[model samples]
Target: MMKFRHLRYFVAVAEELNFTHAAERLNMAQPPLSQQTKQMEDDLGTILIERGSRPMRLTRAGGAMLEHATRIW
Candidate 1:
């Protein structure tokens, strides 16, 4: 079962595309937020985020998850 918190975190990261800002927006530390995102990616067995890009790039799956999660709440 997936946690709604995880989805919320995911969407935040997706929208902000930067962990630092996203973490600030979520009122949490950046490391945990990034860890949560990484955990989500691990759980889904797919790479959600593409590194080495400014503002971070969302993979196709990442975009899809963002859209879906956004609709969840």
Candidate 2:
């Protein structure tokens, strides 16, 4: 069920490293953005953001995803 829009969502969050900021940048509500990102992780079967972290960070898989996503853009 992955889509190009999913990658766009991931890229925004990955770049901001914060869901709220990413949501703002995308001009969408935070909840949907979070849900979409969660769906992305679910679809990919890998953890992207380390939600437990204070400042938040991308997991190794997330880092790799970001790299490829940017190129695809």
lDDT of 1 by residue, 1-73 (tens): 5688989999888889899999999999999998998988988999889967885999999989988888886
How close to the true structure is residue 2 of candidate 1, measured as C-alpha lDDT?
60
lDDT of each: 0.89, 0.95
| Backbone N/Cα/C clashes per model | 0, 0
The residue ranges of model 2 lying beyond 4 angstroms of the native Cα positions read none
1-73 in candidate 2: lDDT tens per residue? 8899999999999999999999999999999999999999999999999998979899999999999999997
- Per-residue lDDT value at 6 in model 1: 88
Error of 2 at 20 (Å): 0.5
lDDT of 1 at 46: 92
lDDT of residue 36 for candidate 2: 95
